[model samples]
Target: MDPVIVVGAGPVGLTLSLALAAQGVPSVLLDEGPGTEEPRPARTVVLREDSADLMGRLGCRELDRVGLRWSGWRSIRRKQLVRNVPLSGGGGAEDDTALTGLLPAPLHVPQHELSAALRAAVDKAPLVQRVPLSRIDTLEQDPDGITVHTREPGSTWWRGSYLVGCDGARSTVRKLLDIRFPGRTAVERHAVAALRAELPWPDEAVLHRQPPWRTGGAEVSARPLPNGVWRLDWLLPPRGELVTPEALITRIRDTLAGWCGETPAYELLDTGVHTLHHRLARRWRKQRAFLAGDAAHLLGAVGTQGLDEGIRDAENLAWKLAHVWHHGPAEHLLDSYQAERRAAVAARLRAADQSLPILRGGGGLRTLVPGAARGHDTLLSDGHLGCGALGAPPSYSHSPLAPPHTEAHAAVGTPPGAPVADVTVTAPDGTTTRLRERLGQGHPLVVLVAPGTGVWDRRHWQTAGVMPRLTDAVAALPGSTELLVTESYPGASAHTVLLVRPDGHLVAAFGGVRPAELFTAARTALGGAPHEAREPVEPGDGESGGDGDGPDTGRGQGSRARVHADGSAGLH
Candidate 1:
């Protein structure tokens, strides 16, 4: 088995490698790191709630330790408050209801800090072979694998079953594939700074939008970092404005002063200027090589979704590869990654288009006044500081992977393709636990047994009884796990069986059914091989079944590729 080759060492590449490693897949991580000490602006990235959950699931627990959690951003016009879009719906304070929910609140972290955490995870995982200072020279794909040629002091070649390009906006992989990235660019440049200062204002983040009345004004936003510094990004005047160090300093001071009555003395840590754009790749995949992160799309600063969306692309692609390798599922399974993620990013781009002008021009300042009407709602809906824009989880109802809702499984309100809400489940022994704690992770189809289903005794199944009929039904499929619990969520009926994919989305659910029939239905919904449904076994007559097999830990078992870290191919 060949390793999956990952290009680029940014957060997305590091994240993709680590996610695959956790699932027992190995990868070769290639990056041309610090070729030169070119100065770069201090940029901060915000992770939506779902993005935070993806990080937590991938074992990047250092985020909360090194990142600041903010409820939302305060939108202000000149010196007056226009509106406050609270992402969590509570005041600026941390909401306990949100903190205790399935996902954590949004986070603000310096780009470097986020990269460092992901790199640390990569360093710790043995399955991830990190080849720093290596750059991709060329790539060619054969029918079964891809050959990647890299250049450093000494050029070398490597092989992989799949190659994922997580390189930045000017992605070499995308260029090699000749996939056009089409979109509009903003001629205006933006200045971003990382600075430290003491302020007498609420800890929440703030975005100051200059009303259209101020023709030559720039929009500025500042957010607190866990490291005691603040990240400030403001639009710079068009090219001929003649920007100077003093002018930049004055701009920062003025922006800060407007938010916090007075600007105290401050130390500038870093600063840089760059242009932003709104672009998407014509295609994210070409044969065996694929694109993720900034390589796939660039939403620019208008929408702080570039990093989060890239992280999501990695999350969506990793599990499918794992499933294919581990279960020998149809290769078509891999196609869903593009189908689902591309649509999601398209929606995000549309939302960004509607809100970018509002952010830069304050086009909706009047509508944000107290008791404003719904006409301006789109302007404040899904931008950098908008409530609806955070994490914008996608619904794959139109995805081929989602089974259509049918009369057979109507009671479960969770429509096909919608993300499954984490529900608290009560055990027969009174032990309580959340579904997400077990549903996600491992690549497998989860069998959730709802309570009151006369199909089996709740206590008996919980303690450890197996229904032989259920075992025989899924025996042919590999890389699958099962869970038994009394229904705690409202949707589960007396006897319910929910077949969920490894990503935690419901594939199908059946109520008041027998084990064989439920298992057969689940297989069919999953598009697996056909299986004949059987009747429920008589008491003690069939093979006993407990929680189904745990995640596959053995090497080279699934249809997915197995990577070997032989170091036969070397890099600096």
Candidate 2:
């Protein structure tokens, strides 16, 4: 069996490859170029605290090294400061899940620097095979596997059990599969420039606009970069007008002059114009082929959320594929990929839509700017910092994969179906650590036993059959870990068990329930084989087999026992 094939070597593809590697799954990463070129014009991105935490877990810390931890943003009109707000709720008092100083607020990182960090990490990952200068021409998928047709000379075909299209907006895979991408593109074009200049501006990002808001006037944003440079994003009129290199520079100077008393000395580093778009794929998955990142959806650059959403997609899909490939889960488990991520993208898109209008000046409603800024604290705490909109955290309560929770669980901290709140957890040895730090190891399932819960025993569970069955199931799952805790949990009993999914979202919280009922819920969450096979095959263990390869390798081989003709061999 060929390795999982990941198309496009951008941040999304790189993240998925690394996530898969963490699960001991090998993957082939392909891109159009040598995969060393930096993104042009130095696109700056703003990552929310949650996104930063995810990257930190993925071992891509270099981004923080070359990025600025931006704390606040200010909006200016007619050379007057209208609204100024910090990105995070001071002291993180707005939300229970907020990790005060543990996590930084939204930070601005240049796109090229971020890509460089991810590329460096990819170079060190043993399981990721980087195939540079390779472009996917087309692909064909059958019930067994997928064969990728590339443009490589004399090597047109590459095979893999799964293919993910991380390719950007104009995705070949999505087009080949005939998936509909429905959304409108903004009539106006956005001009972005990286510059080294002496400007009279604060370190915080400044959104400046001229009067006559109804007509398309000068609306530009300037942000200080960590690398001692500045980035400016200018919005042009809807009418098409060709802007030359000198014209672009003059536009920048004039926009600055309108803000400050006079234009400051500046040296433009790079610049470009791009049209904004808002598009979402009709479907994210089709059999063994799937779409992620910009290939699945496209949002405006108003909030710089396109990259963050793409990374989240990679995190969500990687483990599901690993489970099916290594543990023989029913392929239907992949359905949750679409069910969960599509909802997230929808929420992000809505947030982006809401921000775009405000970003475009809101038809001269400048007075409301102060009011919006006042309410931004709640918006930022709700995890909408990425898109700069007042939004709520994603709710997976309706997710098919998330186990149903009770009323009591709903009233607890970090309600079921929401991302697990980051809390301090103490071990029996007196070692204290954050729950996220313990979960950073990337386990597919983590069953957290509350503090004061006595030594692990099946009899401890009030639900009899459930404990035994769940123990057996968890043991069979390759990347599952059972963590006994001595940390106090709000709204949880001593015997409460919290089942956390790979993406760190609470699926079920049960204090007391029948064993059969919980067991059924666990099976439903697993979604694959009814039960895992007990037989284990060591790669070096003496066993007659084809190719003399062990279960650890052997293309398409799983850790489970072989299915016999009598159907009595494997648990599935």
Candidate 3:
């Protein structure tokens, strides 16, 4: 089997590799070293709810079993506890409450912990081969496939069909492709320090933002980590002097010193000086090569959105690789990688670029008046904390991968960071369960929580309201299914049904249960045509009784594919 070479054993590469492996696709993964698990930088990364299912599917145990979740984050001032801004939604779409329930609180884990989890998960994937201490010296791609040459400080030879660049901001692959990276660097350097401490803060994540006293503007946000530790990050003025580990630590100690009278002992875990750079590669793909995560885009650290965005990139690209390698042409899909992602990065950087000034210290949540609307609340948005802007849904706007839409307003709500809410349901046993748990990864899913009455026949599901192309796709599915019941959200009048993809974001939705509407939705949910208005499956049988994925699913033998270390390529 020809292997796809994945550069960087970090989250993005490992994740895409795992997705491919899960589906029997294989590939090889290369990284500079085991990559230290030192938990160094001391940065806290919040994994958006949307990326959770994808990561869990990749087999990260922290995502599956041990990660910490915060229902939402609370904002605070020097003295007062401001508003508690909800992070993830309450499970907005009405699908199986099972999957929706999983959309509960957002997960907050350290970058290292996350790395450790990805490392473990990838090790178990049969199709993934982990090659540590190895680096790619050069890459050359042609009509047939790609040839990757890898070496360590010392080394040998290896070949592959494709390469996914997950290297950091200074990406060698991006350079190899000659993709230009255009963006600016923040003039104000930041001091980020992680130290063990006991602060008077909530167990949930806290961002105590403040305006820079001298600058009359910039702001700083301090986050608490898992152990009895905390991270203090603040913007320094253009003329601000340089600071070492001790000096930065002392400054933090003195600043928060008065607040916490009995200063808890703080041992500096790690400290670093980094200037935030906002840039996106000129392109994301060239021939058989692709870039994801930090390798593709870099945004100032305003909302801790970098990692989650990368994880989403992997999931999106993984399936595209799977489908093309297993069934169609590869070139047809590569263009979409840049078309879809470049726009996303541009938008994120724009927002980050705008918000950076507020950090140098004036407006924004950092300047919210204490007694004033501590938080300006509205029914439509979540935090408005610049997060909503970055959490902006992903778009396949210019890509052929997404079917063309005729609607005047092309709705794009299913991308990586869109937030969702939760709902209740009448389970198979006539009991209630949540939607989150039901959001199993890998399966193209249709979640129908809206209550509909007419016996949904195939035609009812077809022309009633389904979008032409989407309906066709769903209808052709092997056993595309739906979950039906009453209200997904309490007190909400109209029943909203959303067609969700394998990951937990909405693909299509309609608020009413109009007969014609329900049919269109079912067809849309199924991806189209056959009008599969099949009777709903009984409780506990989420699995469609295909040739057999049941009590006896594997059949006479397990179907398998020959895969390399990086999860790419499949040989039947």
Candidate 4:
């Protein structure tokens, strides 16, 4: 099988390659620059709870240990505390009850650190073939495969089943595909500097805004990074003003003094000026070539939406690509990538656009009267601030991959397109575990049985006349599937069976045992044609059935599921 070609070796591309490798798919990673050991200049990047969870699952465990976790941001206007926006909609990070059963808190890690972690994981992945200093000079795609030629003379063209462009803002892949990026670049630029200083509030970000009468209309935000490093970003004056090193230092000192009551001694680590853009590609896909990360969308630097969104883009596309590669040609599965992600990126861009004015020090009446900006505040509260707080990620309810929602499934609270909550569940052996621990781990498709108030016995399921059919239906599917029988699923009714996709979105949710419906949904989701089922087998009847205690590691104890490092399952 041809390897999937990944352009750009940044966090997003590396993440995509790792995610695919987890699904037992091989990918060739390409980057134009030579690999560097020295960490890039510090830049603030907050990983949302989901992104953090994904990174952990993909083997970037060092992030949680090294990255600082923040609960929220404190907005101060002219030395007066305005609002303390919580990250998880609770009091603060210390409030465990408010965060109970939720994904981990948002992490404040520099982009370099994140890239380093992901790159490390990629280096360890045998399925990934990393090619450094290889620039794509041309891209050509045929009906079956994609070919990318590097700029290096005498170099052979790289071949892959599909190509994804994770290259940054000025993407050569998007340009080669002739996809139009439509959006305006903000005239207002911001100076971001990384400093080594001790901050009083080390766990929370602080945003300070001063009226034009004081500090020359300053708007700055300081977020604590790992160690004593703090990332400071402040809006730059319109073009005419010459910004010298001395002037920048004076501004930084004044801002720190205003926040800390005194200018604490600090060493400037790095500084750069960045122009924000709100651009998004008109198309995310053309044939076997696709766009992700900054290649696909470019939101203003208001909340670090681009980074998190790009990571999500990688996750969303990885599983589908794996499914299609392992199973067969599933056009709908691949097409849904753009359908779902494009809409999500568009929404985030809109939210970023709404929040840009305030971050740019144009809050106006909204700043003075907080109630006047209730709508904008709603966006912030809804996890639009910094990294998406513990709030819900984008929903794909409208996507073609999502089954049509009905009132019953809606009442269950696990909607067809909504992300499955990482609720804790009890195994039949009384072992407790989070739902996410098993859902998308080694299987692209998972059948979660929530026998609410019902016994965990297979006899009960057989008596209800759903076990045999369910088992047979799943057995007939193209790829590996996991059947998890838990004591109860929160927010779902008795005998509830949830068919989940690899990205944690529900393909379908049944309130009660409906084997035929589940079978149809599974086929539709996998983009497989109707196939005859083998003879019905009860639990423990064959190698397919489990020991009736919990989720059965299908086939055998040695068989790999969806995202295993062994690459035993789903690798064509």
Candidate 5:
């Protein structure tokens, strides 16, 4: 099989390549710039909890070591403390099923640091071929594969099964494909600066709002990065303001004085003026080429939504592409990439738009009305204020891959299309492990929860006439399908069967022992025919097989089943 072509070597592209490699899929990473260069002043990104989980899965733990973790944020108005919002309360509920405590806290790390860490992982991955300083001239896609032409000194070309554009806002791939990028750019610009200073409150981010009488009603945000570096952003005037270096320095010194009651010495590292944009491509996929990261959408820098969302785009798409490469063509599965990610990005943009007034120093109507402050406080407490700072990640309940919604499933808090809560479960061997740890192995996971206090053994499933059918069904699908019979699942009733995707999203949850329904749901979630038998190919195999055009005539790998002493069966 040919490698998947990944454009751009930024964090998003690097993540996509690493994810594909993790799934036993090969990829060619292309970037115009050499990967060795680091961005000056080092822009920081807020690595959300979900993205952090993805990084962990990709074996990129260096980021966590180099990032600062903060649990809450502070809001100040005119140097007066207004509110202290803990991110834990932003979108997390006080329930056992909540996903708050299962993952690492959000990390504040530099983008270059993230890229470097991912690049290091990529260097270790044998499946990825990194090509730097190769500017793409053009790309042509046929039904079988895509050919990318690069205009380096040697002018080389490469072939791949698919292409993904992780290039930034001025994405050459998106432009070459003629995809329209339509959205509004904010009239207000922000002057952002990075400095090395010791702040009093180094554990939490600070948002300061100045009244109109002081400094043109600017809003300043300060976030602590690793190594005592601070990222500061000052919302500049809407119009006619020159942000020269001297003026920006003066403004920074004045703001520091107000915060510390005196001007303190600090080293200015980098300064730049940025205009916010809320742009999305009309379509994310065109033929065999797809757009991701800033190439696909551009959100405001508020809450670092764009960066995290782009990483999600890579995660969501990589698994599908790998499935297709290993199995066969599932058009609906490939299409879900755009359907799910576009909807997620659009929802985030709407949330950001709704909170713009509050973030722009106006405080919205809360400042004018007597009782409106309560609503503002609720929004802040809920963590829906800007860019979904502490809000739960968007759901794919509307995606084609998601099972049809039902009230019974919703009542159990395991609705299809929602992320699977990371819960502790006991294996048949009496070993405890996180549910998330058993997933993301580039295959669908069918979790069979034993009813009541009785653990599910192979004898029990065989007596019920469900284990054989499920084992055969799972084995027939492409790739390795994991069938786990846990002793108990949180919030799940007795005898509940869950179909979880590789990315940890619930495909469907069956309340009772329904082998036929579970089989159909597994096939549907994997984008394979109910009875299709296709073999999973090893990466870099040069055999003739399905290029996602149609079904192949190869028989799938046989199941390797093992029965433990507890009579529990493990099938792969």
Candidate 6:
């Protein structure tokens, strides 16, 4: 089969491959750098919960294994710790099945570590092809697919079906497509480095945004690293004097000399100076060619949104691309990928830019800025950032897979992209879990509501037996799938159960009344096969399933099938 080809080995590119790999999408990945991948300790870590789950889905659960689970944040001004806030609270609508709906708290793990773990995770993923140093040279795209020519500088050309440029800010794909990246370069260059040592972390990430360039711009933040290491970043204005790494390090030591000794025999792992610029690509896709991660958009350096946005870009596009590859969605559907994602990136850029004032110590407007402004400045970028708005259960107002809003949601289910109420999630294995558990597992959960309202009462569900059968199958299967059935979820009727993909998209929500109609519509919307030869629903936010409610509206539970059809199979 012709596979989707991704270029870049960075966190976004690698994690994108992992998301596709999880959904069984065959992909070829090319990264033109480094041999071994390991978390560089401190390097820009994505600071969002969705990013963690996306990384986890990419097979980087190793982060939780090696990285520290940091909580809350602390901000300092002139060495005085001022703002201190927690990332989440285990409160609200806590119940027997699950707990507090969700608080958008991010997890911290180095990009290097996340990338390495993703590569390792692909070991079981035959669809993901890793080609390090396999650089791209030529590219061609047509309606059918893409042809990507790659080489080793002056070597033979290797081709691929589709070309995805996740090649970072200086993406060859962007250069090749001649896509315009428009943005202003920051007045100062950002210097990043991590030191390994034991220091009192205050159990939080600390940030210090120095005053503006009047006295020469310089700002720093303190984020915890695994194994007692501390990650520090500096934003320095160019002094017209080319500064060496040694000189820069000496300056940092001078500024932080007090804490330097406390860190023990600290070893500096990696160091690099990058000229930070705020660039946004004119477009993200052309024909069968597309851009992902940093290739499509450049996030300003005011917040922790850069990598998170890239990962979201990958997850959002992967499933849509797979749907097109499998069932041939409308070409316009494919076009929407760039539109929706670019808009999201745009939102991040605006917020990050708006927050820059705080990083520049309010830029002579300290008293003028609202507390929310400064709060967002000091916290959102530096803390285990909360994205209750977009972090968990983010929806696509225009997802091609989602059915055209009937009455535009004239009124059922939570708002698209909205989080569900907090409740317990119980498994037959006797494990009672929390809301975050479903999202963090990296595997999608097919939630089957207990059944209510005549919304699912149509002929579509009953005639096809699609809804009931799938749930029953999932229930019988031991560990391959997780089936969440709840009767009393807050804000939802007893019979309303929602199917949540591991990536946090709402796949199929029931209880509107025309049971079968909903079943059929949902199955069709998500690219699920009919029950005639139905395969188990494939989670991972990829195409895919099922049944029932207790009502005259035509819903019922699945009778236990003594015979197992777990061996059933289907085609692409």
How does each model score on lDDT?
0.63, 0.64, 0.55, 0.68, 0.70, 0.57
- After superposition, the stretches of candidate 5 with alpha carbons farther than 4 Å from their true spots are 87-104, 211-213, 301-304, 357-366, 371-391, 405-410, 426-431, 450-479, 485-490, 528-572
lDDT of 3 by residue, 122-151 (tens): 887778899888877788887767876777
Tell me each candidate's TM-score: 0.79, 0.77, 0.72, 0.83, 0.83, 0.74
Best by lDDT: 5
User: Model 1's lDDT to the true fold?
Assistant: 0.63
True-vs-predicted CA distance for residue 122, candidate 3, Å: 0.8
Task: Name the runs in model 4 displaced over 4 angstroms.
Answer: 85-104, 211-213, 216-218, 237-242, 354-370, 373-392, 406-410, 425-432, 439-442, 445-473, 476-478, 486-490, 528-572
Q: Write the per-residue lDDT of candidate 6 for residues 51-103, one digit (tens) a residue.
A: 66556545566676656555557665554556765545211111232243324
Give per-residue CA lDDT, model 4, range 221-247, as digits (tens).
777766677888777764546567787
C-alpha RMSD of each candidate structure in angstroms: 7.8, 9.8, 9.3, 5.8, 8.8, 8.0
lDDT pick, better of 3 and 5? 5
For residues 1-572, write the lDDT of model 2, one tens digit per residue.
56899999988999899888877788999887777865664477766666667777777876666776654576666556766656553222233334343223565788877778878888899999888888888789998889988886525688898999999999988998899999878735777788877666545666665533332256667777765577887777655686688877777777656555577777778898877788999999998999999999986544446777788789888878886787664666788889988987786777766655555444455545666643433343333244333333355777777654534242456677777766665432435556665543344433443443233332233232223333333343333444434334566654455666767777677653223334444555656433432333322322212222111111111112122434333322
Candidate 5 global TM-score: 0.83
Alpha carbon deviation, residue 171, candidate 2 (Å): 1.2
Q: Candidate 3, 140: how far from true, in Å?
A: 1.4
Sorted on lDDT, best first, the list reads 5, 4, 2, 1, 6, 3
Rate residue 11 of model 1 by lDDT.
Answer: 87
**Ten residues in a row with the worst lDDT in model 5?**
548-557
